[model samples]
Target: MKNYILITLTNALGLYIASLLFPAITLSSIAAVLWAGLLLATISLFLKPLLLLISLPINFITFGLFTLLINAWLIQLSAYLAKGVSIPNFKYALIPAIIIFALNRARLSLIHDKS
Candidate 1:
């Protein structure tokens, strides 16, 4: 439970940073960032696995590159569900997804090394 909350907060921070860095991504307010972050975390936790399972063959063939697309799709879906989060286009969502994915990889590696 604590881990879930931490992950959600990290995602929120990532989104906040993305919004600051990308003109195409916008959060109407701080509350909006929180809502968007929660929505994104929920979608990632729930929908992403199903999509990943459904696309497993392609994921294998693409050498896991399809996972990036899945991340982007989740981002787009979260933006659609969260009223105050706006992604102007699918292309814009890709960048933030990639950024977040890279950050997560770095974080996991740091934890792994520490352990």
Candidate 2:
């Protein structure tokens, strides 16, 4: 539960940062940011693994680079599903995906180092 909440908060922060960095991505309000974060976390938790599995061949071929596309797709999906967050297209979502991925990686590394 604690980890889930932390993930949600990190995702929210990533989205907020992305919105600030990119004019193409927009979050209307704080509520929108939180909702988008929660939705993104949930979707990533449930859907990403399935996508990774399905895209294993391509992932292997690309040396795991295809995971970025999967992350972008997930971000696009989160934007579509969560109201008040707008990502114009898949291309626009890629950077946000990268930002979120970095944030999550850093978070995991910090947690591992502490343990």
Candidate 3:
């Protein structure tokens, strides 16, 4: 649980940074964005792994490529849930989704390595 919260906070930090960099990604305010990111990260904790498992055949056939689309969906969902956040297009969501993936990978790796 602690690890999950830490990861969520990190993801929120990444989203906050993204908002600062893209006008189209702006939230009504920083507080709203923080809430959105937390909610997104919480949702992702269960969703990403389950979706990956359920989509295993497609993921295998696509050589892991379809994961990007799943990520895009997750990002779009986050935007939808967020009261004040918005994304301009698929491209905008893709960029941040990829960033979040990278962060997740790095975090998991570091955690495993520290054991």
Candidate 4:
């Protein structure tokens, strides 16, 4: 539960930062940010592992760089499901996906460091 909340908050912060960095990514309101964040976190938790497993061959062939594409696709998926959050296209989503991935890694490292 705690981890879920942390991931959601991190995702929200990432989305907010992405919106600031990319004009093409528009989050209409704080509520939209929160909703998108929650949706993203949920999707990442439920779908990401399955995607990684299914894409293992391609991911391995790409030296794991294919994970970025997966992240971007997940971001696009979240945008599709969330209201008032618009990511123009897959190209526009890549950077934000990178940002969110960095944020999630940083958050995990911080948590690990505390333990």
Taking all chains together, the TM-score of candidate 2 against the true structure is 0.96
Which digits, one per residue and each the tens of the lDDT, describe model 4 over residues 56-109? 999999999999999899989998999999999999989888998899899989
The clash count of every prediction, one per candidate, is 0, 0, 0, 0
Instruction: Give a tens-digit lDDT track for model 1, residues 7-112.
Output: 6776777787888898789889988777877888888898989999999999999999999999888888888888889998889888778878877777778878
Any idea what lDDT model 1 has?
0.84
- Which one wins by lDDT: 1 or 2? 2
Per-candidate TM-scores read 0.90, 0.96, 0.82, 0.96
Instruction: Give the range where candidate 2 is weakest over 10 consecutive residues by summed lDDT.
Output: 70-79
| Candidate 4 clashing pairs, residues 3+ apart or interchain | none
Q: Tens digits of per-residue lDDT for model 3 on 1-115?
A: 8976777677677677777777777778777777777877877877989999999999999999889988878877887887888887888887777777788888889999999
Model 4 CA lDDT for position 45: 90
Q: Any residue pairs clashing in model 2, and if so which? A: none
Query: Any idea how many clashes model 2 has?
Result: 0
lDDT of 2 by residue, 38-82 (tens): 998999999999999999999999999999999899889989999
